[model samples]
Target chain A: MSKKVVVIYSGGMDSFTVLHKAMQQGLTPYALTFDYGQRHIKEIEVAREVCEELGVHHKVIDISAINQLIGGSSLTDSSIDVAQGHYQQESMKSTVVPNRNMILLSLAIGYAVSLGAEQVYYGAHSGDHEIYPDCRPIFVEKMNDVAAVANYEKVEIFSPYLNNNKSGILKDGLAMGLDYSKTWTCYNGREKACGKCGSCVERLEAFAANGLKDPIAYEDT
Target chain B: MSKKVVVIYSGGMDSFTVLHKAMQQGLTPYALTFDYGQRHIKEIEVAREVCEELGVHHKVIDISAINQLIGGSSLTDSSIDVAQGHYQQESMKSTVVPNRNMILLSLAIGYAVSLGAEQVYYGAHSGDHEIYPDCRPIFVEKMNDVAAVANYEKVEIFSPYLNNNKSGILKDGLAMGLDYSKTWTCYNGREKACGKCGSCVERLEAFAANGLKDPIAYEDT
Candidate 1:
């Protein structure tokens, strides 16, 4: 029997790659997605479709009840417009969801414990460290400490891409012959990806850095 | 304006006392309760009543969606019986919800960050150190480290009763003239508390240590 890992699959390029990487490592991956009332809820649908195609056990937890409690972010609050231009722009700070990674990881640890899985994987790459504090290596390390003793069964938080850039992650996924179209990166929830948003721009840059055109459709391009 | 604090109010004796402690400290208290599909869901209702009577801002977050992901504990799984006898007994280990405090504290920290509150409080005490790993001081300290960096707004995890036993907590509540009947601690979800259960037995012991009769009615009493 293969070891089981709980992957935090957000239907984004990073997590989509993370999920596939878990499978490639011979670990049975259980995808855990959270619907935290984000503006880009389209990612949840994308995640569900990919999970179905891969025959993976997936759970899209609806934590929208917490919307009222964790609002004020462009990702969750309708009033705040999603930031455009480079992902490292100061305006991108508005995209930060308060304590989001910690909350998601905590719940994932609980699920892993319930399933007797020893590891929980999330995609927190180096690029996010500039804008999101929770994505920094230190934050993940501290959370790892809590996860170690949080339950009777110790669960390790495995962020394999913590030091990798988005381009590096994309390069690895391409090497695995993984299709990126199944993932969504645009912060704006629209029929076509808004290439202007910080997320979409960063994703496009990553694909360009890999000397390849992104398979997903873009409204601005 | 007084500073604000988010209290993880479970409608148990410990949290009920913690909620009042926040008010007594002259800080505005926002009560946060989670409906995690526990067998003793009656406690949620009791929490609501106490918050309503106190005119405190309260939210009952329904996270029952994760019930399937976090089953196997007697608290959340119907297949398991509520453990009887002293809470320190080995059988009481079944009552441990996997990583329960980390999940709860994470959400509380998110809510606190959203409200611009600097502090998040819970009712973890020394009595639970024997059976629950998440209730220990080390777990709370590590969670606090994550909470501080999880968001741009620094939030603190404050477990004021971490070193105190249940009797000490009860003494504090009694000194504040708190009404004990408003909080529910029975493991069984019956109309009357099953006095033989670990939680009830512990509560009874706390009252006895205080040399006072408990105000709540029990099945075996």
Candidate 2:
């Protein structure tokens, strides 16, 4: 039996790799993007484009009301600076969005149940564990239990990229022969990838570790 | 020191009772409501008024985007029938709202943590457990684990009415001298409470079992 999976496609390299790997593994990928009142609307724009490019059924859900209701996140607040530098090095307080993964995954789970999809996929990586507690395995387990009891729909939450590093994801994308050029990773709202931003730094480092040149253009290399 | 607690206040009979009880128990009741794109905006109106009546700091967050993203609940959907009947006799399908309490509680946990409030109060009685899986102790236990692991905070998710029947809530509310006249419970968008709605039926039954009359007008009875 063929299984349909919904990947929380964020137009980032990590999610891009997950989507590509899903297709290679003979699974039909239904991509979901969130317009969660992020300062970087460019991410949404990029996510929409990638879904179209990949010819996958995609959904963009609005959860900005959550930001309006629950503020103080650097990602959601204009006054707060998006933390730059290594993800592990950045203080938890600087980048933490407070239950962001929990909310996003919950929305994904709801959509998956509606679509009758077998699984919900997210691109939570190992490197984010120190800062974002919701990105950890424990959160995934606890929320899966909550999702199960709440929906009562025998559903499973998948975080395939949770234990993986940037190099591993980059390698997986390369192994799947994915065109990673279409992906965007910069958190800043700039034309070119600001190499200074943590996202760009991770992407560049991953590609470099894999001995491949990243196709995305950088502004401050 | 007055212990701070966040009450999931909907200005409805049960939530209002819970908020009043929380305050009566010597805790500072912080009223929190969600504008989740429900058809009956009147409930929100009642919620605001009830908060004012209690003289507590009230906040209504716009989770409308989340609702719009989800879209298939009887409470939120105009297309669906607000199934009216006895709570225990209703079809299980009628009870499920796709992880609502879990989602709401999770959001509350986030907000509570931000405010440094360690307790979150929601009113879910035994009569509700007949249809709502979220009203069960199992879900609450799992959610507590999620809150702990996600935020590393000692946030407690409390459903004071969990083991209590409707009659029990009525008793508690009456003991606390809750202003039932100010509380709204009808799902129908009408001036008087629509006794046909499951909520109204439960309310009526609770008051009847408690040997008291519900202090609200009903269109049906």
Candidate 3:
């Protein structure tokens, strides 16, 4: 039997790649997505479709109740506009969702413990380290320390792309022949991806770095 | 204006005490409760009542969505029987919710960050150290480390009862003239508290150690 792992699938390019990478490594991946009242809720639908196509055990947890508590971020709060332009720009700081990664990771660890899985995979790449403090190496290291003793059954946080940039992750996913079109990277939940948002711009840059055109439709393309 | 703190109020003796303690310290307390599909869900109602009486800002976050992901514990799983006897006993391990504190603390930290509050208080005590891994000192220490860096706002995990037993916590509440009847600590969520269950037994013991009777009615009283 293959080792089971919980993959924090956000329907974003990074997590879509992480899901495939987990399968490629012979680990049975259980996809866990969170609906945290993000502006780009379309990603949840995208995640559901991809999980269905892959026949993966997937759960889209509706944590929208926390929206009242963890607001002020452009991602979860409608009042704040999503940042545009470069992903590493100072304006991108508005996109930080408080302690989002910790909350998601904690829930994932609980799920992994319930399933008796000893590992959880999340796509916290190097590019996220610039604006999101929770995506930094130190945050993951401290979170790992918490996860190790948080339960009777110790769960390890496995972020294979922690040191890798988005381009590197995309390159690996392309090597696996993964479908990037299935993922959503726009901060706006429109019919077509908004190419102006920080997330979409970064994703486009990643695809460009890989010397390939993104398969997804973009409003500004 | 007084400083603000997010209190993980569970409507148990420990948290109820912590809520008052926060107020006593001249800190504005925002009570945060989680509805995690525990068998003793009456505690949530009790928590609501206490928060109302205190005129404190309260939020009952419905995280029951994760119940599907974390369902092995007797607290949340109906298939498992509530463990009886002392909380320190081996059988009481059945009451351990997988990574429960980490999940609660993470959400509390998020809420704190959102409110610009730098502190989060939870009711983990020395009595819980035996059966629950998440209640241990190391667990709080590591979780604190994660909380410190999880967000740009830097929320702190403040477990005042980490080294204090239930009796000590009870003593503090007694000194504050807190009404114990408002709190619920039963594992079973029947009409009355099941006095034989680990939580009830421990709570009763705490009251006894404080040389006072618990105001709440119990089934076996």
Candidate 4:
């Protein structure tokens, strides 16, 4: 294989676009998914299917241990209910997983360096900057500096969507002929997407703004 | 319970000293151990025992998935032979787990924020700076900055022994009257300490330089 890059492919809409974009750029991308014991673990299944279709090597790392260690977040804690609404609403902040991108990026850096990959790709869009501190521009910039000195190879983080919102990411996927139905965005782990959840709301609004209906089935679509 | 500090306890002499020292400072320390598929996994059992003795909460997190992800290091990869010599020797660099401290510190920060702890304690001594990049002062300083931006509570990393060497750590352990026999440091995991590996050599030399015999049984002590 040519020089490769590690992608934090979470089997979500944003990450699906990232994996396809990496391939279109002629980079050998390895998909890295995490089983962090989130309510929506079904995303791992979607991630595996996408990797199989793309014919890329995928590593589904069990980071459930970290989730078990830090139990306050609503996404991982059973006691806290996942709030549902438009993502920009303040109540949607309950779905924020603390330091999630940092933990994922750290592991991706280690994996990329170990495999001699030059870069790590994670899909942290401008949409997440409002609630998740780890997804903000400052955190990404600081983490890049930390990763530079953390390893001998100094594998860097490449988040192309840091300035792009959900609609921009959806447009990229539509251009790449991605079957977005295979991607998941529901915080509620059910057979059909809970259209009211913050994640589903953002994803639906993005598709609508892109002049396309979301491919996935929604409870009230 | 008052404010607590999370300790990255590895059931090794240096971390054993950190646990005791944190207690002496009147900080309730919660021990966090990661079973990252190290050759000496028995050390985790030792960690549990020590935490029980200290009457503190112990969290043994299974992060072996990370070891499986990054496979080059000898400590986690069984295919690689652990080199035997003084730790300062160039050959000992094979044992350096890339970004090991950063990964651990990241998890500790998450756990600290979850528990609302003010600080995270790790036992990184001066002796490791020559071989491990992650154990260097620069890496620690950068990671602390990253942690500050990564979380809401901003739990800081407190590495008290960053300037202390093996003998200096051993002296602190002795002052605390810790039973060093419970700790394990041999890189080559076995019923008896492999007295020739880099880890064993540094540990034995530390005890000797401190004018005390190591309490653990060795192959040729």
TM-score of 4: 0.96
Poorly placed runs, candidate 1 (over 4 Å): none
RMSD of each: 1.4, 1.8, 1.5, 1.7
By lDDT, highest first, what's the ranking?
1, 3, 4, 2
Candidate 3: misplaced stretches above 4 Å?
none
- What tens-digit string does per-residue lDDT give for candidate 2 at B1-221? 79889899987888888998898889998899988777778888988987786689888987776654467778887888778787767553664666677678877877787777998999987777758887888878888888888875668889988899878888988987676888888878689988877778888888999898888888756
lDDT of 1 by residue, B133-167 (tens): 99999898888888878788889989889999999
Model 2 spans with C-alpha error above 4 angstroms? A90-92, B90-92
Q: List model 3 lDDT by residue over B40-116, tens digit each.
A: 67899999888898899999988887887888888888999888998878887887888888888888888998889
Residues A37-78, candidate 4, lDDT per residue (tens digit)? Answer: 887678889989888987999999888878767777778888
Candidate 2 lDDT by residue in tens digits, A126-214: 87777778888888888788777766575678877888888888887788788888888887878888887677778888989999899
Error of 3 at B75 (Å): 1.3
Point out the worst 10-residue segment of candidate 2 chain B by lDDT. B90-99
Q: Ten-residue segment with the worst summed lDDT in candidate 3 chain B? A: B147-156
In model 4 chain A, the worst 10-residue window by lDDT is A91-100
Q: Residue A16 in model 2: shift from native, Å?
A: 1.5
DockQ, each predicted model: 0.82, 0.64, 0.87, 0.73
Which scores better on lDDT, 1 or 2? 1
The interface root-mean-square deviation of each model, in the order shown, is 0.9, 1.8, 0.8, 1.1
- Candidate 1 shows a clash count of 0
Among residues 3 or more apart in sequence or in different chains, the pairs in candidate 2 whose N, CA or C atoms overlap within 3 Å are: none
What DockQ results for candidate 3?
0.87
Pairwise TM-score winner, candidates 1 and 2? 1
